[model samples]
Target: MESFNEYHIDPKEFTFLKSFQDNWQAIRDEFIHFIKQASNEDLKLVYDILGPKSKTIKTKGDAKYSAFGILFQGMFIEKYIQVHQIKYPDYGAEEASQKALVLREKYFPSLAKLIEKVNFNDDEIIRNVYFGTFHPGLDIKLHVNYNPHTNRGYLGLIVPEGDVAMKICHEQLYWHEGKFLVLDHSYPHCPHNYTNYDRTVLVVDFFKPDKPREEVIQFENEQVTQRMQENPYSLGVFGKSDRAKVEDFIKYGFTHQLEWDKAL
Candidate 1:
């Protein structure tokens, strides 16, 4: 708890963090290997762990940055892209970064035993888990997590060693593959990966300690990211919500692979 970082959140806050710490390496090694050797079988494994892509329980406006919020950040292509072999690609990244976005999904899990080994007895606080990959030169500008349905939870990110930069609560968080960051993403934060290689964080949603495991999973399963981002929950029809206001002040920077001689 030295003041190396601005905010001082005791690692003791989240009880499940210790279990995550205990198996971090085993989980990481298996995950990294699967991603490196991405294949058809690997893709199926990811599908098994994360369910279907159409049913990926990802929050709207995730790791990607945006000027206003998740809306203009290019996370959803279905709203705009009409033509495809039913493929809406993640565009705007430079030539070298194209593969990074697509390959992240092909590597969510390979160590099912290790993941299952992580248990909290009857607690079962982990609602959902998925891979949140950040590509080289991707800049995630400042934004806050918004969710009104049944408050109280944390956004857990298991990040690896990298030259990534994060600004949250006026402090910085250096990464270690073994470290499990249980953060309140509601605080405005920005993370920029200026490195050459792709950075992956095993993101998990840890709900209220007492929240019924069945209830948490049920709500998230029924509520897709799109529904959470529209109309009553969002869209600012009554007034300009925080998300409705354009984020003209968030710092944004991008890097291309051609600019660097090597990328890890």
Candidate 2:
């Protein structure tokens, strides 16, 4: 792997990369501290919590290119409906929402505690933790994740040995095991994996110290419920219009299960 200092990152193209580069050491140290405290067993606990729901959790992209994501949020979609007393006319929507809630509540508390330790600030509430996997040859096109109110942390767990890299604005970093990368996701970025193996990373999104966990959870659930109300398909799956795609989403939501491979 090449040294980050040897590479030139154009601030004009990657505004976030420039800021990150300037504070790379500090950020890296923070992540390293987190990793030292978190054992492999802790990671397994996270995997154990999310693994079964692998099928239902929505990943972005099409068959040609996709990145799987396991979302940990407060209030399962099912519970959300019951708590808010929402009555969905569509049976499919009702079932999906209920199922989503059940899965979320199953492991949310444990996952939240584990991730909270990583932030090193108990006051900073962890809003969501997404465990993502990118298959070989998957190229996530340039895009910006707009969340003005949160801080995002990326922990590289399983990275392929060859030519797989993530570009945050102007700078590029090759993936490696145990490497930590922090960024302001509101900036433009993309990922390219040229290797013949899968790459996995743990993404932690949290609110600032000012926001309490309960408030953050409430805000997030409201956003999720509103999205579902507007478009049932918007719940977890994205960009699908055809019947077959919809069926796949439904099937995955109900029975698509994934197990954590100890190797990863």
> What range of 10 consecutive residues in model 2 has the weakest lDDT sum?
235-244
Q: Candidate 1: where is the Cα deviation over 4 Å?
A: 3-8, 40-111, 114-122, 148-162, 210-264
Off by over 4 Å in 2: 1-124, 210-226, 229-264
Clashes of each: 0, 5
Candidates' C-alpha lDDT: 0.41, 0.46
Question: Given candidate 1, what's the lDDT at residue 66?
Answer: 16
Output the lDDT of residue 13, model 2.
33
Candidate 1 local lDDT, 1-264, one digit each (tens): 344231335456666556656766665665656656768764543333222122112223434421111111112122211211122132322321233223333332333333344433524454344455666677754554533222222222434356676656545665556665555554455667667666665555455454565675565444443433432122121112223123323321122233233444
TM-score of each: 0.53, 0.50
Candidate 2's TM-score reads 0.50
**Candidate 2 collision pairs:** 14-170, 76-101, 77-101, 78-97, 78-98
Query: Best lDDT goes to which candidate?
Result: 2
